[model samples]
Target: MGLLPLFTSMLLFSWTTLNAALKITKVDLSIEPSAAVYRDTNVALRCKAEVLTFGTEALNRVYTIYKGDSVIYNKTTSSSEDLLYHLPQARVSNNGKYKCKISIMGEEKASEAATLTVEGMSTPILRFNKANITEGESVTATCLALGETGSLLFSFYDNSKEVENARVTSNELTFVPKGVGNHIIHCSYLVFVMPNSFKSQTSNTVTLTVEELSIEPVLKISPQDNVYEGDTVNITCSVSNVTKDYQAGELLLSQDTELLKSGKTSIHVNWTAHARTPMLTIKCRLYLRDVVKVVNKTISVSELFSVPTLKISALEVFQEDEISLTCRIAAKGIKKKSKVLTIHPKVPVSTPKIWVSGSAILGRKVEIFCLSDTGTPPITYTLWKANKQNQIAIVHEFNKAANFTIVINEPGRLNHYLCKASNGNRTPEQSDKLQTAVIEPMTEAYLMVVPDVDDISEGHTVILICSFLGTPPVTVRWLRDSDDLNPLKTTTTNINTTSYEFVVNKEHTDNYYCQAENRANSVESNKINLVVGMAMWKKLLIPGTIILVVSSLVMVGFILFTRSRRGKRERAAELSVKPASPKSDDSLTVTLTHDTEVYNAATDAASFCDDKEGRVTNGTRGSVASLPADISNRSSYSIPATV
Candidate 1:
């Protein structure tokens, strides 16, 4: 029982303690929450602490929670720290140190303590994502943080005066200040501890940046002065630049309480803003990193971009022409801004589209274009031509310059030419007619006559030869002297060729002429002169007359001999015929010869007797009446006697 026994016991105890300590290091004391609940309402609290090592006796730890001289909770646990605990209820009377103690080797070690002030209701942490309140109307602000479960006195104070108050049981508290001023808030615990009651602490001081109720923030956009549809703009929307844009929205940039644009080389905004505005007002506040209200600025969004002006230009152009055209367009706009140019949907400009007339002759061209003042790729152009026939747009050029040369072909054709250009949305520029002209071609008509006279007989024909030159086929109106020949004898020329033989005659002796005519009612070369030499007049008649005279002489001699014998026979025959005196009527009969000449004559029969009816009476050698004979009589006169 003396020294030896005591030493053995001490050794055993020491070994036990060492074993426990080693095991404790391996013990996982993992906390469940990511952060601490620094404040609380009611304080009926309980926590768990247990030994997990099997080599050691399983034991529970005791816990104590406190706040400002007040004990909030005290409890003993038999389960692991992972275990959950439930108290009958939270009470304002329960508040204090939040700590846990465990027994080991007969020594006490405590867990970290958490103070719980059972104020039941504390002045809420009037916290706002934003610190400064901009000028304008009173604002309702929410204050939030981990707190006790009992009712919380949500309050706002101006220094020491109460500005607002609310009852809250949730983790959050809200308060609204009536005006601008410095404010302080204090929360006193409602719970009492063995040695002391709950203490109160004042909250962080706050100064409301209040100025006035903000009129509904006016809104505006940059370049609002004038704008084109489908154009890109550096757009913004804001209550004020200092209050919202680069200052507030751009990484909390502010001076004192005044909101200012961030100095970042690049601009970034939590939200868009309109910097270009007229009379459009908004509230702005100067600020400090810790949220101090300085000044609120009212600013307007400025017009950063202007409506684009489209300029369309052309050097030359003419009307009534058909040819290619070129047009030029120009425009200006903000950088990094996009703009579109819609050419005159139609190829030509909308205005008197300065263009070459479809009927224009060659040597001239026209141009048309559209331009933008502000925007990317702000110019557009087109070229086109109308034909001489006045047919529209037979050709066109796009996005190019405008210029055209029209080749006129039609006569007296009027060309109404025009051009247009445009920025996708802006009005287009127009050009005037630069030139005008007309064109016509040459035309002609005539008749070709080829005539041949192959026959030239006494009663037959004479060849008449002739021909002509000109356009189209022409009719030959054959003419003999002043007489118009029948078409049957005339020939229609074949294109440029013609030929025909007309009967030759003395009638053709004079000038022979042929006139040609065309569908245009046009006349050609006057009657061509033709000399028709008459062969009939030169050959048969004159020579044949001589032969006729000789024959007649021989015929007269033979007739005399036969006449002597015929007289005796004629007398005997007459006696047998009951010889009667020659009747004067019979002797008065006229005999006609087959000649081109005719004659009528009467001679007195003095020796003839007449009856009462004017009939001639029989008488020896009675006188007779006869037709006048040819002046060149060819016979010898003789008289016959009657019995």
Candidate 2:
């Protein structure tokens, strides 16, 4: 067992020494150029294996290269030699983890894996012409990829976000950014002819800053035109979109380059506009660190807010008068405007006027107008009779300058009308009452004189009344002896009668009559015959006295003659007788008759009938006692002479 143990120890010793000699002391993995290689370029990878000591014999050594977990190349080398893997031209597919393996003297050792990457082109560079610029200003950026032979796909990014891509090796882009911010600009490129394809490595970042500029100061004015004196005008100079923090600057209000007001904020300038400054050109100015903004405005001052003028077409107004009124206003900075108004003027106030258009006779339609002269328009008329409250007829019509017409169907006496007018602008107005009279129809006229006695005494005052009966208002005329009498002697007493008074005389003792005339007809009164003479007592007394005188004289003469005859007959008596027979031619006869008051003596002869020439002759006278028998048979009467 001891011998076996010794032999085993020797074998273990040789194995231990051999194991120590084959163990790798150092293993190194590297790539030529020590950095990333471009596409289609030659690249070499080296792996070195070192041991504690070298073996003299022809050592059995093998070298192997691995990419990731797969072997790419295998070879044999001595213990003192280094391993190299060459790629004639690197491709994009040659990128990955790389490792080397070595085996010598029947022992193997491995190295840790290293990484290699192949790109299509070199890294691009980004450059900006200006680091900071105002907004709306142009900026240029350049992208360059060195050692790039073919076309390159270059992409630009702002803030790690891709903005644009172009297929050019060297590119310059000019643009204006609207926003204001810190912009980081970088470029990435890919080689079109390289084996590897993808987004390339990014370039170095360049910052491009854009800021917003302040706007020009704008001048603002209130009450643009027609500005009055003692009015406040507001002016403001303001800047917009300021990029940096700024304080309120001086805002200037200037007129014709002379500063009127200046303040850090908006200002109100109270300016009195007069003839000196009828027109003004004002400016507003704002100031920054080294920048200024100015704005100008023009203003004109004139009259404003004036009272409107009133014009009337007429001063005096009557009924049915058309009137017009105009109101005109003239203002500054505005067009002139006017208003025209139409008016219907009213008449003066008084009682209502009433008139009948036609005759007011019975059974006739009469038109009555009740007019009120005071109201505006649209008068209503109503007709009524006396002692009645009810209306006869109503007229309602709208006429601004017309009267109301009321029609009566059958007009009668004591008819009254009333009128009312209202324009809805004032109180209702009324008119006075109107009464009507009866109308007369034409008729035949008749006239007469009073005191129908035909006798008129002289030197007597008599009233000759000429009375006429006809329609009222008959004219009376007096006529004497078929001639017109003077009007001074004729007096009218009433509408239908007249009177005349005069002293009766010889010239006035003529026939008088009256003629009455009207519109219908005319007629004359009956004639009155007047006689003027002496009194009846005086005329009869004179005639009676004359007749008495004549009768007395005759009686006295007869008596005296009788007395004288008696005296003469006593002195001488003589008788002469003539006897006559009955048949004889000459005879004396006598006859006597009874007494009568009146007697005629033309044929009487008798005896003892005393005649005026009786003579008594006794002796010679024959008695006439014998008469004719018939005459003697008559009654005999004694003759009483007498006294």
Candidate 3:
């Protein structure tokens, strides 16, 4: 058993020693090489050995071993410290598998393998799942191995081919795509091994698709084209593959201001938006599309024009001169330049030219001469006018003195005058207007009379009044209220000086007036009414006619006298029928009594009858008082009795 333990111990020692002896102690190279070598160039190789002193203090010491007369390197020779080998040139031949032996100072130590492999370059595999990748987006790339241990260095490159860091790792690498282009991306690396001591592992060349910012977003708008002055404009920014979050920068409109976006790619641009009330242009600007910074566009509108300033000047003027008038307007905008223009006429005047003169008159030949001038050109103006019957005197031809009468006709009405002016080619500028009254008397006629009123009495005399107005000496006739009175109505024209007498009677009480009517215009004098009132009695009837009244009165008196005479004769007859009794003389007995007595002619007549006839008793004169009559018997019928 003890032997077994001892033998096991020896065996363990041997195994441990062999294992330690075989261990790779040091792997190193002399004459360091640059990381990159151009194609087809000479490159040198150097190697040193130092694995021989693993268990001792001489662990860092290095040397070489000799083999035959060829002077080859070994563990013991100092030449092994720096063994140099110069290759002919860099080529396929230059590509390599290089080797070196490692040893400690005394014992032949561990031997290991390394490589110097010329990577016959081929471009890496360039591939991208997407051609475009937006910024801030996550992505990954896989480098497929062309050969060897299958590990590589990861690198990033900008569109300019600028190299980024080379980081070594196994399998795929992750990154955020930073820019846009045909991105050429591949990886390079080294392998740990022999003659071809190191192996460069390359990936298949690939293109990484990275997204870039757009130039200007295809500006999407709700109202595609025109927005009114007062309206709002809305624009939306979008990158086909990007979310609104990335486009959430600003939309610059018209360069005036900037606006921030939220989750929305669109924003409302508010404005008062007044466009063409007077015709104008408007613009809008938008920001942050791609590498490009801004954008712009325009809009338009139209407005209205109003009536301008106007009025009149002077009232009246003399003949053979100019009439002063003016027209005015409110000044507006940038004061305008002059233009060519023409004028319209007043009261139907033909070719009424404008002149500088300010005043014009009525009848004497007037002049209106035009002259060229500068300044705000006045609107054209017609000749001054007033009233329907043109009172302005006229001239057919402008005198050589430029004296032209504008008023060929007359007007009898009030009028409005204007100066219609323009800058030969543009809208006009008018001045304050002038008004003038036109009056003429030469072309007219009227009525006149010499003795307007003459000769008259209270229902008796004659009076005549006369007057006239006319172009020429016109004759006049005296008319009583539009009527031609008969010759019997007036005296013969024996009087001179157009004076005539008129008889005033009760019949002429109405209008004893005279009208002296002439051809031109007529005139009449006021009426003369006559009052006829004369003496109360004598004047009423002719004196001779009153004599006839007296004659008729005399006739009536004679008839009454004759009637009284005839009546007296009849009475006398009656009285004679009785005879007087006796003529009692001297002293007739008289008796006065209370009751007076009446004399009885009957008794006397009875006595007279008795005496004539012899009286008998029975016949008693048909009664003695009855009486007989000698006159009665003559047959005058019977007289009425009153006695």
Clashes of each: 105, 4, 110
Q: Candidate 1 residues 1-643, lDDT tens each? A: 8999999999999768655653332212222231122333222334434444544454554544434444545556654454333333343434444554454344354556555443333443555444555443234445443334433444445557754444343424444544454334432222235455443345555455544433222223344434443343342223343333333322233323445344221222232343334433333333322333322334343455553444334323223424443433333443322245343322323343443324333232322222222222223433323412222222233333444444443444334444444434446554453344442211332333334333334345334333444334555555544765454355666464444555545555555554554332334334444445546656676678778877787788779866855664444233222225545444433232333433222212222213112333455343322312331131222222232
Q: What lDDT does model 1 reach?
A: 0.40
- CA shift at 80, candidate 1, in angstroms? 99
Q: What is the C-alpha RMSD of each candidate to the true structure, in Å?
A: 53.5, 70.4, 62.1
Cα lDDT for residue 288, candidate 1? 26
Model with the higher TM-score, candidate 1 or 2: 2
- Against the true structure, candidate 2 has what lDDT? 0.61
Best by lDDT: 2
Candidate 3 global TM-score: 0.22
Candidate 3 lDDT, tens digit per residue, 1-643?
6999999999999767755664434655442363235444456556655343234333333433221122234333433345555543343323433455554423443223333334453334544555556644555665443433322344544443535442545535566544565566665444432223333445556666656554343344445355543455554444334455554554433322433242223444444444323333232333343333334334442211233333333332223435554443434231222232233222212223344343333333434442213222222332333312222222332221122245424443223433333223434333233344433222322222222323322445544443333222333344454355542232222211145555555455344443332322434454544344443354556876888899999999999987866664454344433324532232222111122233344454445545754332431212112233232222222222222
User: What residue runs in model 3 are displaced by over 4 Å at the alpha carbon?
Assistant: 1-463, 468-505, 511-527, 532-541, 577-643
For model 2, residues 519-611, the per-residue Cα lDDT tens digits are 435677777776665546656889999999999999999999878656544432322234443322333433354333333334333343443
List TM-scores for all candidates, in order: 0.20, 0.26, 0.22
